[model samples]
Target: MIVIRTPGRLSVRLQPRVLAVGTVCLLLTLAVGVLAVGHGEYPMSPTDVLRTLTGGGSPAEEFIVTQLRLPRLATGLAVGTALGLAGAVFQSLVRNPLGSPDVLGFTQGSATGALVVVAVGGGSAVLAGAAALGGIVTGLLIYLIAWRRGVHGYRLVLVGIGVSAILTGVNGYLMTRVPLMSASRAMLWLTGSLDGRGWSDAVPLLAALAVLMPALLACAPALRMTELGDDAASGLGVRVQRTRMLLLAGAVLLVALSAAAAGPVPFVALTAPHLARRLTRSPGVTLLPAAVIGALITVLADQVALRALPGQLPVGVVTGVIGGGYLVWLLATERRAGRL
Candidate 1:
């Protein structure tokens, strides 16, 4: 740990490996973004993509890059980053890898909300809002149900699993009650499509991040402290419950926002932080690194969905397949270590 201190005696510790991992992940994300932006039905070279982005390409290239693909990429980046950040904070706060919003049923809540909108004849424009509301409500419910004096990691995890299973059933029931067409729409959204997404979809997610990320940074120091058990954190002058609540609140909002934008693309939330941790070899949370990996995985998965298959597939499909495999591997590894 390298500590930098100011004249006022405030110090920040920097981990070199974490910094290096973040940088590498960021570069990879950008490279994949370029690739995703350049290749489509009307493929452009990387140079054309760069030139178009920088205001130097022809009108057609600009149309394809700017109007066609950029917004989708932007939305993907925002959703991935949101999930990654949320996952890191949630896992860190709960001290459990299975504590992600997806596993905890927050994403199912979001899906239920969007399904409600579909059932009510609402359009895609309102689906994100409904999803966000549902996720928030579900988060509050989880907190209340899990709170006993204060929330414990293990108890919260157990309660969240139960809530998730219930929400899964609810989502299935809601799907059956809707009309066939509406149910189809709901199914696509539940599968987490980025199809036809535009600037409007990207803006709200970016704005939410703008407001919420600083709060995450502010909570970081305390978040690390909270990792050292409640007793130790409290001994170190940390307000354990307060810190936990703040972290949970921030994470929930992030999960809600991402689900709103991208229809709860699975496994990004659950896998990105763990991948970041392995790359960084860091003990605590690698929030920034996780965010980068999240963006990378999302954009890369979307690319695979678009180009590697017979037809374009929903981004969620690719993520779900990849994330499912990663989860199996993780569970096996943990089981062998007697930690499962």
Candidate 2:
């Protein structure tokens, strides 16, 4: 007699391929991060940095890497992961490749909220919370206004673009009202900087990751069902509208938290998912893989901004340049395929 048995397990199961890709990315990022530690203005050898990392270096070397570089690296990792995952979720939820908080005005709304708090001289924590609320509110408003016969992806995107433009104007106008020194600082924040970031900045970002990452992971099964269209998803007993709302809220929270921590580092949310899809050849945007790629991009870009440039360049500048090129290439490729 032959018996078929089901294995009982409470362990997390990851695809062997996905695990392999993730491992490669993690290793690459670590190697690049180590290289980055050696390329700053006051250069330290990789050996010295490694020793400092392992807690056996001189005081100055320890101060440079552990105190300065480590915090910046940590911030990059957290913020990039947040943006990338947020982008993947938004894109999958809306079923549009271009759907990202940065493009859809969510980050713009967050920026406006943070700017308001800054203008009013509020604390960073307050700014972060307000920014999150503002992002959610803006996304909801866009969804509501774009809801005609039903929510069309193109219509939602257009409405979001309009909202983003208005928010950009408001951000610019608000900056004009602040004093010059404060305005300069605000401008740097808008452009996104990891300079002078410390353990303090990591706290809120870590908190957001702790809260939202699991929520997103939990919703993955529902989101997977959602890809089958609302009627089909409803047939499968998924609460379609509720699932969308939850996903949107999670995405907004992730983007807002990252923006609050790093001040709107652009395009990670827009480009990372697409890059992941291409890399994995996955039928859809894979959130975890995208987040890993985004973290790598941000950390490496920050390193370039810090070391390769003649002077300090904000991380956003590097991202914008690379992301813009990617966008152009995507458009060109789509046009060639008659899909644009």
Candidate 3:
């Protein structure tokens, strides 16, 4: 661990292996991103894709690469990175592998918010704002309800599961109330597609990630200390409750913004951190590696969604199928190990 300290400010300890793993994941993410941009219906070669990106291509190539593909790529990367970071925070805080925004009702809450906006004939901006509000509200509610002497991970998880079930029902009811055309639009968004996404959709998520990433990184040491138990964390000059609240709030915002940008793209959050931890062989959650892996998974999944299927499918459908299977496998493995 290499510790960097500026007196009275946050100190971060860097692990060499974690940095190596993050670098590898980022390289893989770039490779996948290239494949995603180059292998679409227009079928630009990697060289052509690079040329277009570097402003050296023809008008048609520019339109295809810059206008059509780049925005979608940007949104996918941002959303994936946000989800991955949020998932790492939650999983670490709860000290449970299953802790994630989707599992903890945050995503469903955002979906519910967006669905309500759709039902009321709101525009995209309104929908995004409402989604963020809904997620933040739901997170606060869950935290309050889960609090006794303090928030316990198991209690929070249980409460979140119940809240998720309720929100799922709410989403279903809202769907039924909307007109067919509106319902179709809502359903498509809810299923989470990168289809037709432009810079308008991508920009806000990028901005949010830009601000939140550093804040989370600055808090990383405190977060890691919290894993040693509240008493130990407090003994080490960490304010446990305050740190938990801040981290939880940060995680919720990341999920809300990502959901707003991409519709609750499932399983990225739940899968990315665990995969990162395994890849790094890290005892603690590896945030940067998780973010990179999340980006890679999302970009590759979008490629498959657009090209591999007979008809273009929503990106969420592909992720949902894979994530659901992973969820089942996780349960089975945990049960076998007597960890459930």
- Most TM-score-accurate candidate: 1
How many clashing pairs per prediction, in order?
Answer: 0, 0, 0
Q: Candidate 1 has what TM-score?
A: 0.93
**Clash-forming residue pairs, model 1:** none
lDDT of 3: 0.85
TM-score of structure candidate 3? 0.89
lDDT of 3 at 300: 71
Q: What is the C-alpha lDDT profile of model 3 across 1-340, one tens digit per residue?
A: 7789988898877878788888987888787787788877779888888888899999999998888889999999998899889999999989899899978999889989999999988988899888888898999999999988888778889999999999999999999999999999998888887888889888988998888898987898898998888899989999888888888888899899888888889899988887777666678877888888788778778887888886999888887666456556765665335332
**Cα shift from native, residue 218, model 2 (Å):** 2.8
Among all windows of 10 consecutive residues in model 1, the one with the lowest summed lDDT is: 331-340
lDDT of 1 by residue, 275-331 (tens): 887777787888888888888889989998998986899999998677567656765
Ranking the candidates on lDDT from highest down gives 1, 3, 2
TM-score of each: 0.93, 0.85, 0.89
Q: Candidate 1, overall lDDT?
A: 0.87
What lDDT does the true structure give each of the candidates? Answer: 0.87, 0.80, 0.85
lDDT of 3 at 310: 68
Pairs with backbone N, CA or C atoms under 3 Å apart (clashes), candidate 2 = none
Q: lDDT per residue, candidate 2, 1-340, as tens digits?
A: 2234457644455566666777788788888888877766778777888888899988888888877878888888888889888988988887888788878998889888877877877776686677777776788888898888666567878999999999999998888888787777677877877877787777778788888888887888788888888889889998887777777777887887788778889888888887776656556658788888788878878887877887889998897667557756765665335332
